[model samples]
Target: MKGFRFGSTQGAFYILPGHGGWEATYGNETLGEFSSPQQAADEVARGLTCPHLSEVDTSTLEIPEKLSDWEIVHV
Candidate 1:
């Protein structure tokens, strides 16, 4: 079965299709199960406290060697 991952410096959380619904996990540990992929991804984002992030200092930001730092990897 193919699924996607949200990776970080710490590790990665995988969102995959499972019995009856979608599953969000960090390695062998289950984060939660949801009825849709968006919910599963939202749960993980909520856990990471993304809403409270401070604004970045774009003045110092430089272009990455990659066109975009983000990617969608199916595993």
Candidate 2:
């Protein structure tokens, strides 16, 4: 469904609609669920600030970055 996908040289993650709120997912595991998209994205953003995610240094993309990292979470 609808979600947000953003990343840097580190890695990428998703903030998709979950059971009753939002879910932050990396390579495989669903890190956690939050009551709002911003919370989920913030959580993923925290992990993105780290050295690595799921112990894998990735980001195969070599193109220019996005104009903005933020997304329309609601409305």
Candidate 3:
């Protein structure tokens, strides 16, 4: 399973596509809107001691299947 997972080692705090424009979030709480997903992920990495949660952006990651549910259905 591959996907973009955000937040610290505590748990998934946010998602990228949902926020867009490199917005970082924790649940409904918007942590901060970064210029890029990498930046947002970096900030999280600095905050947390975990490396897995730090890497973000074009970097290889698995896209969660659940996100498909939120995708816009093109007619």
Candidate 4:
């Protein structure tokens, strides 16, 4: 289960199914607990710039390191 990757500073994150909720993690480090996977992903993505977010079953998401210099579209 891979997560979004935005350059080196923005490390990998994941949303895993837990007992009553989902767990958001950065590598082996647990970031927080959420009620749903979408919430987890949104939370993580909120902390970074133009993160290439993906689902748990999806492949690793990659974004150009120079994303900060490019214009990003939000929707």
Extract clashing residue pairs from model 2.
Answer: none
lDDT of 4: 0.48
TM-score per candidate, chains pooled: 0.61, 0.58, 0.46, 0.48
Select the stronger candidate by lDDT from 1 and 3.
Answer: 1
Candidate 3 colliding pairs: 2-62, 2-63, 3-62, 3-63
Runs in model 4 lying further than 4 Å from the true structure: 1-10, 48-75
Better structure of 1 and 4 per TM-score:
1
TM-score of predicted model 1?
A: 0.61
Best by lDDT: 2
lDDT of 1 by residue, 12-68 (tens): 656788789988666576767889767776556545322122432211223122212
| Candidate 1 Cα lDDT to native | 0.55
Tens-digit lDDT string for candidate 2 (1-75): 667765546555667788999876665667688998777655554443233354542223331233146453432
What ordering of candidates by TM-score runs from best to worst? 1, 2, 4, 3
Off by over 4 Å in 2: 47-68, 71-75
lDDT of 3 by residue, 1-75 (tens): 122454333455453644346555555556666776566666644452334445443223332334332223222
Error of 2 at 41 (Å): 1.6
Worst 10 residues of 3 by lDDT: 66-75
Backbone clash pairs in model 2 (N, Cα, C under 3 Å; residues 3+ apart or in different chains), count:
0
Model 4 reaches what TM-score against the true structure?
0.48
